[model samples]
Target: MTRPTPAPKPSAPTGTSAAHVPLRWVGPLRISGNVAVTETEVPLATYESPLWPSVNRGAQISRTVDAGIRTTLVDERMTRSVLVEADTAETAYAAARAVHDRLDELRAITRATSRFAELLAVRHEITGPLLFLRFEFSTGDASGHNMATLAADALLGHLLAQVPGIRYGSISANYCTDKKATAINGILGRGKNVTAEILIPEAVVAARLHTTAARIARLNVHKNLVGTLLAGGIRSANAHYANMLLAFYLATGQDAANIVEGSQGITLAEDRDGDLYFSCTLPNLIVGTVGNGKGLDFVQENLTALGCREDRPVGDNARRLAVLAAATVLCGELSLLAAQTNPGELMKAHTRLERLTGARDAR
Candidate 1:
């Protein structure tokens, strides 16, 4: 009998965090009494399947991640936007840039509170009398929509008081491109971009995944690249980066819709010394560690179990979580590509995990 073992904790999160925010509706908020906590051991994996137990709250994590993987923190940026009806495009642009510059000069780059906002870019567009400004900032640990909105309102107030001849339009002009896949997000780069790469020995690949490293490399090029290009995909071509991202996102209570940006990623594999060198780059990973549902019993327990509660230095916790997310995505990509190289492994696993097991559990 082949029983699954505890999943390897591949650089899991650490630290403790708790909160008592009152969810007030035009009144004082109250606590829910779900003080979720994880003491020391990380919950990298419990045991899980791709389907059925889709909630994945307590589903098992995988143990098949590459052991010799190297992850890099490439970039991290957050954005907020507003629309302004101004006399001219240049006028609105100057108004927004002035505030952004002022914020920059203060070097208010944050390291505390999940709501820290440090200006990154003040983007602008104009169509007739409508001038749109997408105020980009690094909003620490929170996925930052609320924080960014708050900052946008304040900036609009600032523009009204100082910029002259500019009136408010909308706090979120959709021009900011939140929860959408856009060339702007790809070009300017929103969220954290983390890259995970590894060299899998040929023997190991053959033994476990039943495919040679060289073959996996070629498969990556032909399938993910050429096939994806023919399909007219944008900024992505992989087996299932979103599979892992969605599982993790749901487990951690992140804004699920942001998976739109989260799925805007690339997977690369190369032939090297009879070993396959592979990497996955995830951009626009709008994830948070402190707010949203991080305080809930299931979400917080998962975050804490994953050791994702480092709340100091503002964005550090979020950055760490992004790296972990990227790494996990890489694991899933590698596993699925290996399965693709085989004939029936993918379907067999699905039938067994999703159908047979799921049905049996229902009984």
Candidate 2:
């Protein structure tokens, strides 16, 4: 994957002298990396009810209760999409065709097949094996975590059954990282669960580019960037940002625990237009509607406000929020950089704001 161009140096702030400090400069400026800025919005589309034959009303009620808590407890059902990538565009197309054919044949099977109510779409292509497939499945009122797993497992089983010479070693399932095994052990004892894997060259490209971008951004840090900022401050900022976003995710019927892995965001900044040009990315964001949890009083309201209903077009609102978060952090960092070079002005402004607002502390 090709790396993004290096950022230009930022011009020194003008007009305002260090004497005209701002109250906001008192707190440590938190900045996210480039990986946190890129986002793609997806709309939740209609799917054939996979729950009807699989779940009884009583079980469904239990699922509703679980969904209310932003948990992923529910009956297992299948929902899947296939992605294929290769060295060349032609090769990739050929692989996709093969996978698509295989999926169709699987749908024809007795216990393994069912027609998808929603047609699948190719989300985006980054580089290498970096392709994303979003299956808009309706998991009733709870998060469809189990459903996604079942679908992936069944699909893998079919693929293995039909394709010879492919071993488990060739496949690596991940929502966030390989270390999920450790996190799962800490949270839910060793329980075997279903997982999803999509093969896409674009995914590989995206990952490589993202990693490179992060390295480039870190290199831009200088002596002035330290002292004022704590050691490992960037990581701390990311963690703080993740936690804040998790609160919103929980409040909105998202499986907040997934944030433990999916909460990662990347940021990249360069000098542009006399300001910083920045980008961020977040992946593995699993959200659901028409689940048990979404029926909660506040969740339903928030989803409505966000236009996230079962019938609406897949939206990019979530991605946009992530980008906004990156921008906020970049602004904070710039403010902090200025403050470190000239603290007296910032201190005075912070003091004034505290007195005026009756605030007791200033970071």
- Collision count for each candidate, in order: 10, 47
| Cα lDDT of model 2 by residue, 33-93, tens digit | 2212221111111111111111111122222221111111111222333343344554444
Q: Model 1 residue 40 lDDT?
A: 23
On the 0 to 100 scale, the lDDT of residue 242 in model 2 is 46
Q: lDDT of all predictions, in order shown?
A: 0.64, 0.33
Off by over 4 Å in 2: 1-144, 160-239, 314-363
Q: Please, what is the TM-score per model?
A: 0.77, 0.39
TM-score of candidate 2 to 2 decimals: 0.39
Question: Which 10 residues in a row give candidate 1 its minimum summed lDDT?
Answer: 24-33
lDDT of 1 by residue, 1-363 (tens): 999998974432332112221110010111111121111222222224443232121111222232334567777777777888877767766665665566653234332222477766677777867878777777778888887777777767766676666888888888778888776776667777777676666666776667877778888999998998898877777766766676557666687788887887888988788777778878678788977777666577666655578445667777767766665666667777877777887788777676764676479
